[model samples]
Target: MSEDHQPETGEDETVIESYVAGCPIDPELAGQIVRLADLPWNDRDVTDSAMRGLGWSDDEVPTDEARFVTAAGHVVYGDYCLYLPFAHSYDVGGELWPDDFWGSLPGWSSQRGAGREEFEAHVDASIDRFAERLGPPECDVRTEGRHLAIGRYSWRYAAWRRGGNILVIGPALDGFSYAQDEEAVVYIGEFAKDSPFPDAADFLNLMHT
Candidate 1:
């Protein structure tokens, strides 16, 4: 799936961890998964073990493409599914020092708008309005620019960095990063529940549960 693709729901409620840099899959893999799953369970076709090898448990076999795919522990986008375990990512060497990486970032966040158009609209309006109040941005991202294409964004203070936040806007699985100190992208904790960036955090909060 494209970076902007948001994650869909699953039965276990555990958001499949995909979209992280380095771990990439074919965007059409889900359709293939559905097709492979759709085939009649004849010996000539895919076997149960083969299905399991693709990350489907015995009961995970899809009876209905839409329902089963969404319910599987995999991150399900429009027509693609991500088997997170097989995902490969190449990390650029960067040292996030002193702070605990997980602690600095948000704990379990969601998206605001329902879909790309909806989410983009919300982001555009909110950021524009924020810029108006702040009186000219350090950098104008009034458009839903390419930055979000990576599925995550990091910002602080008036700009994208310290005291700022990071956003995961993938359609299959959305999340947030509160800040990045030095090398580590900080996860959200109790630190900035009340944001200083106008309605920035508040706006994104609507999409997340």
Candidate 2:
């Protein structure tokens, strides 16, 4: 079947572009992925269960939102790529990582802990791992405060370059809750000097894939 003739899922699951040489990701798409990453899941356990329901493989799922995938059938938003088996509490009527819940986690009293620090370090490691799995680029890790809080949950941000473009990855804010207990939510997006899509057809070509 030609790429243009494929069925439309209408679930915001269409691809926007193909792998182009030297082409960079669009800023609009990158912003959208960042918003998606900031989306809150009810809790970690619910997120895990959602992944299972989505039929994602075990390895594709992670205990934190610091992973990326490079496959044909994977989900794409602008320059961002999403792996399956992720959970979004937005579907279940729960806020992602509500602030009140952070107090419940052990060692989270002051927003600093071995666990929190470890989580941040893990995120750094994940970015490096993703670069190895995808490709190489300049890498940077940024944080706003001493603690990594997304919404109710704390998280860190990691950005890297591949070719002439930049890709950002991180966990969603308010992605954690006690009732649901979501571990993490991963998000990816790209930034480049020019739009990756040369024209409308180029964007559509990505959808066909």
Candidate 3:
């Protein structure tokens, strides 16, 4: 299932929140992330234009700042997902950084296959890595044995707040006409003011975990 649409939960449910106080960042920087992530994920150019309209520059995205390129041809750039469609995104807490995203880039080439178990282990390690930056996660859990469109799957994830935006480190998976593959992934977004769900707990309930 695609999370392309906003969902409304039927009733009150527990919300996930971090009891640990978040480390602070420059308010302006946090605002930029919030605004950028709030843009529609369906289009890169559209999102870029919207970000620019709101005074964001492509230079501000953390891909380069964070050195998110892999020697394996995978990249963690904004809109990279548009080119590489993953099958099991959000299926479990995190995804595989699937070998599917491996392809030729100007100065980059990928092996086209990475050990799934190894990559998944790396995804799980992200919580501590992120904690180093964002202080502590508001919520981190392994939702094993959760039902999905395919079958039961288990994944772990961690969430941190960078100001108004909610950042999550989770495994991703997806299936298409040809095959299925997993991807390493993270998420940063927030509920809209008019959103039906208020916090992570409410929004996550849609997963029915």
Candidate 4:
């Protein structure tokens, strides 16, 4: 069920290499994560460029969990998705996330599609990288219950607040799904504000999430 669209090119791989100038990331993928996370639902042009520039491809037809994958068909890299806001919609950041379906929250996330050992190794590398890239985490982010399990939800994570962006990397995302064995992920998102209903910043976050 791949998309009609083909992946861009090696440019995306190039970018990852640049960012990986060897660090990994709670913020291990810091530069890329923040840039992708901050992109709202409506940001199609930038999102496309960003994803392609990061080696993502629509070739791996979107699934229930991801709109598009970072390394479309890469085996060892695991499955990663950098979800962006919809192009045509009236959603503007509001109503909070998961609890409100029509809310403007984006799930900028990734999970290791490899085996348990590979996944653990990847997560370990990221933690080690984050220690050097951005230091210790700010706090631990956890899901209260099934209510927070919207889209790809996170159950618990170590958080790092870099200005308006929050980098959360650890276990969860599938917070309460029946297929809950999958663990280890990274989520970068913006801090939500109490904006009035229908704010432009919403960017159709509802459908995307």
Candidate 5:
């Protein structure tokens, strides 16, 4: 799909676009996911049971939001999510570090037990780990920008598909803004028919076997 599928004008679309980029799924399906994710699920223990099966103790489970283990082994958090399948080599540096959730990285700051060199090394290791699961590198490392930004191209999930090499951008305000391509973001709304709890048991059992 080309990147031109996103709406170019409208108030609601503008607001939604900030959180959602290029969504290939049906509008109705996307709406369903968003609505389901927004629900409080206040009168139920739906999320609890799923987390327990996924090896999460009661303490690790979040009360306000939910976390899901993607088929590729990366963890995704939130209901209304923007899934970015990581496909490019990054060039992040001090300019992009120590801000928002990106600052949460272990060595983004000297106070976090790492200097600039150590932090860059940590990022290299992370890239290596991801590459091992995905494939070869296409671009070299770059370091320019106060905010972490991708280049003009990146592969994203086609639609409602799951698994594979991807970065799950949650309904988080701090960590995301716009993809370099603008249309590389896929809006994901995950929900269950019977309940809001994730079906971690089935996947957990599969993982064990």
Candidate 6:
């Protein structure tokens, strides 16, 4: 079946709850649900094996997508159905680094907004820091001007890196405007342990859970 097909568990009622509440669905749970829906048989042996492989008990697993919304009202959508874990933010300070005593560089201004050059520099610095902490395998960087394609939004640029696995960053937007000037936001996504760019829906689905 196509990846976009909603799992049997994702009912209209669940969609309503997610929309009204603004809660994200859990992707991990969704993955399990999708697998269950696609199962050829309902036999105990077959179900048990699949559940075991997913590291979940049948009862613990969600039967449909409706069960995904959290009390906070986050809705998981897309391949992995992963939610944006924390509120979106351009302020990477405390989130990405806690004890590290590094400040934004002089040439880089998160305030003036980052251009291609500035963005590239910032990502390079981030790579250096990431490497220092995790050690490095491989890395690459790219930048572009504003452009809109998918949907109506315009992405400033896109960056992809591969070390132990794939790490994507870019198309940073005006978080304040998007969140009504209340919350800062940035779009970042990680792929499977060693995969490049996750199956979009699967990745988003995982985040929701």
Task: Estimate the TM-score of every prediction.
Answer: 0.20, 0.31, 0.43, 0.43, 0.28, 0.27
The list of candidate 2 runs beyond 4 A from truth reads 1-114, 134-137, 146-156, 161-166, 176-185, 190-192, 195-209
**Residue-wise C-alpha lDDT for candidate 3, range 73-164, written one tens digit per residue:** 23334442212111122211113221212221322222212243544555655555656555777676665445544456666666654443
Cα-based lDDT for every prediction: 0.28, 0.33, 0.40, 0.38, 0.29, 0.29
Tens-digit lDDT track of model 4 for 109-183: 222122334444555566555556667755544444333212333233455655544455554322322322333
The regions of model 4 sitting more than 4 angstroms off are 1-31, 37-45, 62-65, 72-122, 140-156, 173-179, 192-209
Show the lowest summed lDDT stretch of 10 residues, model 1.
180-189
**RMSD, every candidate, angstroms:** 19.1, 19.1, 15.4, 15.6, 17.4, 17.1
lDDT of model 4 at residue 183?
36
Best by lDDT: 3
Off by over 4 Å in 5: 1-54, 57-63, 66-76, 80-113, 137-143, 147-165, 168-209
lDDT of 4 at 131: 52
lDDT per residue as tens, model 6, 1-209: 12222223433332211000011224443334434434433244654466457653333212243213222232222232222211222222222322111112111112222233443344344444434433552433232222432123222222233322233323233222322111111122333445554333232222223
- Best of the two (4, 5) by lDDT: 4
- Ranked candidates (lDDT, high to low): 3, 4, 2, 6, 5, 1
lDDT of candidate 4 vs native? Answer: 0.38
Estimate candidate 1's alpha-carbon lDDT, on a 0 to 1 scale. Answer: 0.28
- Residue 6 displacement (Å), model 2: 46
What tens-digit string does per-residue lDDT give for candidate 5 at 1-209? 22232223542321311111111223333333333334333323554344344453333332234354322222334333323221112222233321222222222211222233432333344344434433443222231222334222212111122232122221111233333312112233333333322222222121112
lDDT by residue (117-206, candidate 1, tens digit) is: 433333344334434433444433221322443345432222221232222212212222322111111011112324543343442332
lDDT string for model 2 (90-199, tens) is 11212432222222222222121124344444355555555554554343433343232224343344454333333444434332333322222233323344544222
